[model samples]
Target: MSKNRFFACIRSSFFSRLLMGVVAAAITGTACAAGEAWPKEINLGYQKYGPLIILKSTGELEKRLKEHGVTVNWAEFQFGPPMLEALNAGSLDFAVTGETPPVAAQAAKGSPLVYVASEPASPQGEGIVVKADSELKTIADLKGKKVAVAKGSNAHFFLIQALAKAGLTLDDISVAYLAPADARAALERGDVAAWSIWDYFYAAAEIQLGVRALANGEGIVNNYAFYTSRRDFVEQYPALIDVVLDEVRKTDQWVKNNPVEASEKLAAHVSIDAKILEKALRRSNYGPEPLKPEVTAAQQKIADTLLAIKLLPYQINVQDAVWQPKGK
Candidate 1:
């Protein structure tokens, strides 16, 4: 109970409390940093052709994301349905697809996808084609004949609308659900009277195989390409999504301004002839923008049509899955 002993005991207690406070502050700071850290890698899904292909080829997105200590991985899909399937499965952080796939994805149970952005409609970018010598001269001629189309693709919706215009339904035709490559082969082999497809495949078929278009999307479909992501990804990484969309906007402008040059660059990555790509590119529109009510309404019409034809298992509200960015 001496004075020195009392003083020493008091100092010891003060130092111990101070040390504890410092440790707590350090732990809190570390936790906050960890919570805000960007992902080490992000997977982007793309189809064979589009602004994404040009973006991937230029390495611009990779370069920008690299500055944030992130890596980019690209997955290529044959068409939109399978791409959106991968997106919903958590494999892709972001993806671009024709409007039909998103409608289909939104209809799937427990789907976590959200429509983030959309490209302007390019009605001429897709079509139904037949061999130049085929006797099927019109969309009505497809009745009772085998028609190849990728299930759940924009081309599928296009075919449906085209058929309705001809006073026919899907029951009137024998549908052979096939990927673009297989469908092309089927058409060439006369196994299918017509093939529903999108460019650059549509363009390739015409130039490479001399197929003639029975009809295009001009007055039938919008053929809008959409940028979509997992709902969680959009909520968690709004800034990153902004970066991605900004780059997409820039690339879209470039493609629109230089169709031939863009086609050549994309051709290098896809190994398709530049001429075919240019033909497709010239007919297509670009520029990614936020979804408008009209666009959502158009999507709803597509959804309703699919439900009527039993293409979708159930009805879905397209607007429910549309992403609302923070503050809007």
Candidate 2:
């Protein structure tokens, strides 16, 4: 062959190999980026009622996670406090609860909890109730009277706000720290003058026992539901966090759009009457939202209130525990 042609051929071959090398590296980089480190399984905590229950019942989240080879393990709790306790104990990777539990959890020493997302405030969903014929007509009437409430739960915050509006504090009232069943029984037996609680417990009381609410959270407190996870879990598996929140958002929309069907599904799991479940569902606000600045401020107010009342040991910045994805 001619010398010029031999050299030309070598140059062409070298350029072709370089182009292939660049394309191969780009493909490998894309694959690595796509194949993020996802856990094989995740443990989720849920209460008997709420969007989480809806999500669990429909099995939509399970089906989606299954596609990623991630199995879901669900753990149930009666209320927010215990569910959050499990999260703090490392038994749950993710969970959702009402406003107060996250505040209490964040205040606890060595808690690994972080606020990942929140649902809209459903102020009318919880309240303080008295017997239909009871003399307690106003919040002011509760002074020195025994009131049943779940300690460290959302109802606890509601009771505080209620009492404060009446110029009373926790010290002025006799607080019987009891679970929902015991509280209901206490209210029925006249052992406590009133019971402060959230629905479907509130709905059940109204339906089955003819109890009357002195005041719902309408003007007293913003009863927000929050989704939480361990700080490490959020940091390590941010993508999983997005997946879970997306499912929760979808489920919330479904519940809002079809309340009757959602209530029936929830009633089946909770063993409560579908009618009562529907009542509670109607009062609740659906849709999961991120921790916006305004939300953080509202949460900060709860923390400050708890601190002022000595319910919390020390002051905490609610924003400190908020999770932020890579770019806003």
Candidate 3:
């Protein structure tokens, strides 16, 4: 063969191999951008409240996920903060929590969490309670009093707002950080002036302990619940998230339709008195919604409130942690 022909053939082979390498690199990059693959099982965390308990009792979530070859594992949390911790640790793929917990979780660095859905504000579900005969008849009366509240839960925000409306700041009161169980003990022992809590604990305290509400959420705070997932899980399985939300929405509707039966069922699971459950459930509005602009705004307000009080380390934009489904 001629020298020119030999050199030309070698150059052609080199260019062809380079072109294939470029195409292969592009495909891998696209796949990575798309996200991780689905796992055989997904973990969900829930507190005793809300439609999650109903979903769990009925096995609807398992049935839906099972169709896709994904099994469901459930974990129960006493409050939103710890449930969010599990989510941040990747031990939970999906979970539901009160609104404030998501903001707190997102404010922490390296948290790959995103809010997917939320329940409407049912402010009456939570409140501050004092002994029926306590002289602390108003929120302003809490000044200089030792008040019990969960550090990062919804009740924390409720107490903050109630105090603010009463022209009192968190600084005005001696804050006692306690969980619902311990807080109830303190309240019963007269160790704390009041306890900020959510139901069925709040209901039980009202009926069983004869603790009268000093101030309820009502106009002070909007107690919205949120469903969140790891960012990767949301990106990879948007459809699955939709299915879970749909099922939960259905459960909410069922609760709304059968309030009595719903309360009785939940009372059985949590072993709380049925009458107290009924009182709590009566005041609740069970509806799940997608993350809307107004909801995000309210969440941002809560984050800003915490930041103002120096409770949050840094500012967080709630919209940044919001999950936008594919093609939305």
Candidate 4:
């Protein structure tokens, strides 16, 4: 692609009826906050932790979307909540984030989002971790200590559950609300005692920093990530939503069938060790149903926790958030 075309693709894009309008101000839904309008180009927002990082790095979806002149624009974010922030502002058409961010968004009335798909839930696998050398060994040990997490991520839920397990409250620990990059940096510098994270970012810590999870999330809750799209986009370009889901499924299937190759690719993409990538890859549980009832129940648990803590204004209808294939 020419430099001009690439820049244009990055600035804004369309997938049939999907649009990602890059803007300066803060936004939280597909339609501009000012009710400006939705665009025709498709913009794809993603994060480093999402499994599609592999698909992104491989230039797979871009190549596919280009065939239809659907110009694919990829934006990398630190976590789901902020990415959803962008999508809600109409700056992005689609993205993947953890289960918690969308619920928070939904609570904010910034929620015109629907599930594109879901990944495997490995309880105790995704969680709050600490440097093996740290004195924080269990959830109880985190009391009065600083815990790092993206403010509205699934890891945030982990932090909450982990706190409860320790018989403590959010006020017990000094919550250092930071994105993944900042949290990782702080963890590396011993700025914070513990870090809650998911996938590639999660693997990077265990491998590069020798961080060990202090408490696993097994029975605590399933911290699964989600692929979501703007509600307007899903409705207008249902076929494109299918394409996006298909691409994600293909990428996930590839990871399932070829761990070694997938790990190598992920390691290269994240600049982590292949062995560490392999470990994280093993933790990535792929689920076929994005909004399965069990998954919804799990999401509800997180939602309920958030509500109990007043992180949300009211209960969000997670069932309405799922995007099922038409006629499936």
Cα RMSD (Å) per model?
3.5, 5.8, 3.9, 12.4
Candidate 4 TM-score, C-alpha based: 0.82
lDDT (0 to 1) per candidate? 0.92, 0.91, 0.88, 0.77
Model 1 ranges with Cα > 4 A deviation: 1-37
lDDT of 3 by residue, 1-328 (tens): 8999999999998899999999988887676556433458888999886789878988988888776798989999989899898899899999988778898999878999999988888899998999999998999999999999998999999999999999999989999999889999999999999999997789889899999998789998888889999998888777778888899999989988988998888888878788898888788877777888999999999999999999899999999998888777
Better of 2 and 3 by lDDT: 2
lDDT of 4 by residue, 1-328 (tens): 9999998886665532243333322454443433333334688887664466888888887777776667777888877888888877888888877778888876767567777777777664576899888887788988899888888888888878878887999999899999888999998899999998876677777777888887777778777777788777776676676777788888888988888899888778877678877877787677445577898787777778898888888887788788765556
Query: Could you tell me how far off, in angstroms, the CA of residue 13 lies in candidate 1 after the best superposition?
Result: 8.9
**TM match of model 2 to true structure:** 0.89
- The TM-score-based order of candidates, best leading, equals 1, 3, 2, 4
lDDT tens readout by residue for model 2, 125-144:
99899999998899999999
Q: Candidates sorted by lDDT, descending order?
A: 1, 2, 3, 4
Structural similarity to truth (TM-score) of each candidate: 0.91, 0.89, 0.89, 0.82
**Residue-wise C-alpha lDDT for candidate 1, range 1-328, written one tens digit per residue:** 9999999999999999999999988987665443344778889999889999899999999989998888999999999999999999999999999989999999888999999999999999998999999988999999999999999999999999999999999999999999999999999889999999999999999999999999999999999999999987877677788888999999999999999999999988999899999999999999999999999999999999999888889989999999998676
Top TM-score model: 1
State model 1's lDDT. 0.92
